[model samples]
Target: MQKKNNYHFETRAIHEGETGDGWSGATLPPIFQSAAHYHESAESLSKTFAGETQDHIYMRLSNPTNRFLEQKLAALESGAGAVATGSGMAAINNACMTLLRSGDEFVASRSLFMSSYTLFTTIFKKYGIRVRLVDPLNLDDIEQAINEKTRFVYMETITNPGMEIADIKQIAQISHTKGIPLMIDNTLASPWLCRPIELGADIVLHSTTKYLSGHGGALGGVVVDAGNFDWTRERFSDFAPFVEQRGRLAFLHRLFKEIHVNFGTTPAPLHSYLTAIGLNTLGLRMERHMENAIRVADFLKDQPKVEWVNFPGFEDHGCHEMAKTQFCNKGFGAMLTFGLKDQAACFKFIDHLDMILNIANLGDCKTLIIHPYSSQYISFSPALKNKLADPQLLRFSLGVEHAEDICNDVAQALEAI
Candidate 1:
């Protein structure tokens, strides 16, 4: 059956990646585990090497399993194409390296994932790429920060453990006005909750290792190009190489053929295989995650010992309204961060959790909790880290567990604190 563009997300999630092979007729996509494919003829090899034909020549450049995941994600995100990477940071790094040059600027939200902030401050800056941090909630701040050298505006759909929602459309509009593209990390707000591309973003990214996989077993990331931004636009001279060669698909085409392949950041076929299976149940899992999260947030908000809670679904949250406008009716997301009485209480709560896992990761089938100051933000300087990550903050990632049971576990943990 031919697929339609108007297909619902739930349907697309399962059907988009499956391509039945002529010989096997296998319902499941078999991992193309080999490292290389032999070219049938010199003409075919020339076509493939010259980009005249889109065939897998080397696993480092492309793999059938990775391509399936890429196709499915591209369809789900409403993107023109996608590139999968070995890890989430690789996706961000490659995107920056491909689009930015020395002295080029990119605006980003201040309260982003710690690793991203570190990437901007330590890594990207080392290459002379400048990162300008701004308040994500302020449109004026975004406008003021952008200048002629600006290449893109980047932010998370929902700020990491902070759980603050961003006005994606507003930001995208601001970026477009300046001939800059808006790039969003939609890891926390997977397409099931919010489709960033449809909200006016040019590039949507993900750490598929998280919720998309629903399991902590694999590590992978993807960058999906919305095909909205015109690379031919004169401001992006960095894109000249691709346009001079590959035309419209300049950015993604070069990214896949050069930066991704040459840098050796390709996603493994095995990881793609597992992520594909995980995506099959994303809709069902996200629903349960939303349900459990809301219940947990509501329960946390009422506790006398808790100092503050930040969940976009909460009326008291800074971006509750923005979240309501941007996300599907399923509530903000499955993630939230709350403050306890103090640092001591935070550790006590985390250490006492019975059912929830205390690992540093989020977006899992089993509930996960962590003290950001120690786990996720450990690499930063003490004073600066405190500014970025509150010492008393506890980040919670709701899972597909029973709400009541999850609530009870949180309650018991709080009581112990």
Candidate 2:
């Protein structure tokens, strides 16, 4: 309680993963880049492979650097343990593949990151798995989507681009009553803003490529297990061997052994190291990011050329109250969406920007702007694109830059349009 009231996010981000690498008194974990490990004896190596001991056998399995980041992430998210992966989508893929079967189904929020929507509709669909999309704001819609065969319920801490927030506590309750785990994609609401597990989510996933690696040079993802889900139900028959062996670690064990190793989505040690360095400043970055978002959102709303602005920080926003409570009233988030006249106006604004980069990425220390309707959601049907946001919507990822400078740039760009 003391730490939670203090700058716990900052304290935990820097201190939680410090187990002392032993050889060097270095402050941060050193990167374990080698692909192979030489054990003292054949029996020791054999024991590692047999799961009798916890040791790094190969880079494909684990690394000290990746484990360091995983530990820090687990601590920050209040999770039981964490597994790092090559990309955010890799984290989602591995976690879902671990829990789902061929004939199983799952319920998900209609407002999802573009790639996630594709993976659920296409890849999972190809495997004979079904995904039911529903409005996360409606408890009845979420409840109706879950049937007997539903394996889990998936949602985002905050919907990407859509700027929607779920009632996680109530949603978790609904999922629990049906004997299912609630998985949340917490990439946008990084632990500094919200820890989904503390709100009753059973699993949390992140794209460390974003806020966790604030500089945007690293690409990584992670899965944080709360280790509080009921995995012994008969419906989880496939988890029998894993449960019998690992008990509380059944999900982690199966994730590492069956899917992660064979799928080969291992994160590079350098990526983990870079993410760790960025994570140390996460609390700081998030504070400025949220502040700047509010300044920018307030500035954009009054612009004459701007058609509409959607930021949960605004009291009139549909999710404002929910976001307020979920984020502990700290701030809404660093992301917001505003619409222009049309696609042409969006392009004109982008061409006029001086400092902000026109990129397909978000959650950077450097502000980024993207037109999802034409870029990220380009391949989607017209109706689907509009469903997520207006055809002329511009998604802004506020950085730690001076709010005045950012507003000035935005003002000049709108004038150019």
Candidate 3:
């Protein structure tokens, strides 16, 4: 499919990157699963390896099926280019490694996904990269955290478990003032709900294992470059050569050539195919997800067993207005964290639920629930755990199931608790 600038999001979602098979006339892209492609001549193969021609050399570098998904994701996020990865953590690692050298630092929102927090504090720290965690809503704290070695600012569109929304545009302005890019993890607010690049993000990432796949089957991730950041500034002297060579494509060039390729974070072609199929129905699935979420939030709010709901769709949420403005009032996201009476009630409710799955993953077609304190945030220290998790809190990922049935299941589960 040829991407037309005038195409609406729904049309682009289904048609943007799909170039139908010329050989079989298949409307859907077929998975090119071969580990390597044969060239007609040794000269052509040499040219490809030498960067004089474009061709797949090995599965570790690229695949046709993954390329198709990358194009679609880049188009959907309004980015210039994308690199698909084996997992969301790989995308994060690739982005960080591409930008930050050893001993350099980056600022990130404290309310990050558990694995991300672990990656920054443990893995990246072990490699000598320093990470400063700040409150996304506090501009003063973010400003204070930045230093001469700061490479970029990172935050999620909507935080995990906490459900807080960051002001991307404001943070981008702050980051740009210091000659640093703004990298956003847009997993929760998938491209269907928010395009962070359009909101001034220089780099956007997603764990396609979640909503983009719409099923909990495939594990994949992607980093999309907006192609807008100026990498020629004095603060980023390291990127000068890439900027001179690739111009607006400098970030993608560095990411693909340095971090992604070297680390071998390439995703499987079969997983990419499954993700593409899921994205075709993203607009439809997100609509149902939002609808079901609102209904579920309302039901939980009225229940006497529920202590409080932290969904942004609720008017009382601190970032509710910001979410509406940023998401264009389409819908607040489907993820929510609600508090019950205590840890026992939380576990009992989760265990008693009939319809909702008690799983660690989110963004499945069926409702999923998890207790973050014990599952996702188990490694956090007491102070860190208090900041990001609660013993009585339950994180819920609403699905496209009927609203009434979901509510009934929750009600029965609460009653049992």
Candidate 4:
């Protein structure tokens, strides 16, 4: 959120991506649901294929509606540009595939979301791309982990289930010292809370299915490039062609041209349109989400049956000061996990909830609850599961509902235990 720093956040969120319909001049973006765009002349179509014009050749390559969403996402993240993908996992695949070669290796956070952890350790490993995982809070260990084989440094702005906040500014410095770009998964913090690029990240990622959609009605992802990284360096020699042609937009160009299109991680125009609409109310929703979260976290901390509440919002948390500084004190976040006596108690409590859903998803307008140990990482070994976070904890993604109502539901659920 740097170059767009001149505009107020709320104003940009609603206005930045809006390119009205050509025929109707509609205020909202019109979904271009066609499979391909036809031009009157071959020269016109040829120019677009040659990358001379920004016309839509095919839906898989681009769409007018998706462009609007991409623009708003880039502006919200203060990036040079952004590219949309079919899903969050697709976004990660496109990004890592764009840079990592067979022999290359990268460093990532140990407390990653389960899918990301599996992708890094399993699929990428099968392809001969190794990942070195480290604790998010260990800055010294992170700095030491980098070496000649490291291509880039990656981490989540806020760890998903763990809800840990790492120092983005310091970590960015560390990555830059090794002449590697820093990639941040900003899905949890959302742009309303923090923008990693302005703090020093070169690339930012988001799962629009989460806070960006706010309503949890869309499933999409975006990759935003800061245009601040130097791809002309010898280490990034593969990007030489893109740097020469696309200049500062080299990463975005390679992403769309080589990875996203060929890999077929294209998002539907309807999802883009709905996400664009949902984005308009992000600022308001995030505030209410945060307020409700603090109220809920505080309530859980005092419960006799609850063993512990793990939320960075509280001052007792080790990362509290860093989260306060990083998020500019907006509020810690809307996600938290609290422990019960055991996993069985967690399941019993979840079964008794009246309003909160037991769905696997998070960041929904309707409050969601899940027992991480049994559901999210059920296949993981006991040691690895505990290493990430407490296996007995119940994760909560608080909604915009009233604080009193959310607390009351928790009270009733606790009584069942």
Candidate 5:
């Protein structure tokens, strides 16, 4: 799919970044699974290795299948360039390693995926990098946390389990004032619901393992450079070499050459192929996911056994208006969290479900549910857990299945409880 014209998202999702096979005329991208490419002459190989020409040097650096996937993702997110990673954590770690050094710091939204929290507090902390956790909705807290050492600001488009929406445009402006970029974790919203780059994000990250792949099969991640932020600044002095060489592509160039290459976070070609195939129907799948999610959220709101419901689509949700404005009134995401009578009740409800799978993964073709308190947030202290996780909370990832069937499963499970 060559980006021939300015097409709609649905069309771009299917057509962009895919050039049909010259030999076989295959509509879909073929998996290029070779470990290394052979060059006709030693001089050509040397030139390729020296960065004098564009060629695949090794699987750890790049692959044709992966490049195809990157192009599609960048186009979808309205980014200048993108890099595929081994997993979601790899993407986050790659970005952090490229930007932050010893004694440097970064500000992040308090409501984050448990693994992300762990990565910052445990892994990054060991390297002498400081992370300040602040409320995404509180600009004052974000501004107060920033100092000379702050490298960038980070937040999720839709928080995990909590479903809170951040004001990306406002946060981007705040980050720009201090000459730092805003990085958004857009795994939940996907490009179908929101493009963070369009909303003023400088860089966008995603766990393609989730909604982008649309199936729970492939584990992959991507980092997109929006090409809007200027890296030639005193704060980002480390990027000077890349900025001098690549200009607007400095961030992505540094990401590939400095961090991702050494970290060996390159995704497998087969996984990239799967993700590309999954993305073709992303628009269709998200529509049904949102539709089913709203019905499920509404149904849970009126249930006697349900203690509380937190879905951004609901009018009473604190972030509903912000979500509407940012997402252009698109359907609220498929993920939601609701409270039960207690932890035991939550476990009972999950155990009684016949159709929805009890699993840790989300954004699957089949509906999935998980007890976040026991699974994702099990290591947090009680105080931190109280601030982040609900003891009775059950996070649900609604699939594209019929809304009535999904509601019936929940009703039966609640009745069993």
Candidate 6:
């Protein structure tokens, strides 16, 4: 879809996907809650199934509302196209499945979403796809990890929970020089905060259920193609199977059209509508979220009781300057991690928070807090635990709420500590 001129980010967010469908001219895109589409005749059905026509055959293949979201998000991420999936893990799995096969490999940052890290190490590895976990902040480590079998380099734009930032431009250059794609999971730094595609990333993936939705209500994910990588440059022989003996659909073309449908992890229409509603206010909400985060980080940094706080926005923290260059005055996103006095203090603070949700989720309009050790990373093995979790860590997803109120809640909770 072509992005029209004069429509700023915020404007595009609100108006990009709305269409004048046959129903009443609704200002918002209507939820196309459908399971299967009817065909006029058997001939038409054959055409649809044979890829001769582009129309929804089943909800598992495509849905109107999801298609609208895919188009809008593709434009937002500065990509050629996008595909939505059931959840963030589904999106990651789809990308991995499309790129890597048995004996193929990929490099990923060790600091990743706990669930995603598990998926890569446990599930993808089980399929003979090897994942080499490295510190993405070190360009040398990334380069060393890549070998002949490596298909791509994957990492989160902003490391999850740890808040470590990656030098995307440098990584992109390294990957491109080696004739490989640089795939980044951009959930932590949403499009509002950073666009990895512009920095030469080949593909950008998102768990839209997070900051993009700006709410915890919806569940969905997206994989956007930057359209920058030249698939014709043939380093990957896996593209051979997709070619079908004809020069028809190249690498990504076949993946998006065929593999996506065959896998059948398509996102639902209602979820897409909710995600659209959340995206419209993304810029505004992120602004407040960033502001609140800076305040919270500053507050925690000064607390003697607080052992340490890690936020890319804070100058003392690692990667603060890099974050300043990457994230436009958005102050390095709303997530910040801190070490409290003890486990007892962690529970006390969580229990005292009257306004914030103490759920295992993040990026909601309301502030959300979690003790990562007991919640998200609980399943990690002793060895993996050393790599994934910090015992004293308390992760906070600062929301758009008043900074003073948030601080007061933390203050009362700390007093109990």
Clashing pairs in 4: none
Q: Regarding TM-score, does 3 or 6 come out ahead?
A: 3
Models 1 onward score TM values of: 0.97, 0.97, 0.97, 0.97, 0.98, 0.95
Writing each residue's lDDT as its tens digit, candidate 6 over 371-413 gives: 9887777777877786678778889999898999999888877
For residue 377, what is the lDDT in candidate 1?
Answer: 78
> Any residue pairs clashing in model 2, and if so which?
none
Off-target runs (Cα >4 Å) in candidate 2 are: 1-7
For residues 13-43, what per-residue lDDT tens digits would candidate 3 score against the true structure?
8888867454287767788989998889999
Whole-model lDDT per candidate: 0.87, 0.91, 0.91, 0.90, 0.92, 0.83
Task: Tell me the spans in candidate 3 whose CA falls farther than 4 Å from its real position.
Answer: 1-3, 20-23
Poorest 10 consecutive residues by lDDT, candidate 1 = 18-27
Q: Give candidate 5 regions above 4 Å deviation.
A: 20-23
How far residue 192's Cα lies from its native spot in candidate 5, in Å, is 0.8
Question: Quick one: RMSD of model 4?
Answer: 1.9
Where does model 6 exceed 4 Å of error? 1-3, 18-20, 241-252
Would you list the clashing residue pairs of candidate 1?
Answer: none
Clash count per candidate: 0, 0, 2, 0, 2, 0
Q: CA shift at 285, candidate 5, in angstroms?
A: 0.4
Between candidates 1 and 4, the one scoring higher on lDDT is 4
Question: Residue 378 CA error for candidate 2 (Å)?
Answer: 1.5
Q: Rank the candidates by lDDT, best first.
A: 5, 2, 3, 4, 1, 6
Q: Tell me the deviation in Å of residue 267 in model 2.
A: 0.2
Model 6 is weakest, by summed lDDT over 10 consecutive residues, at 243-252
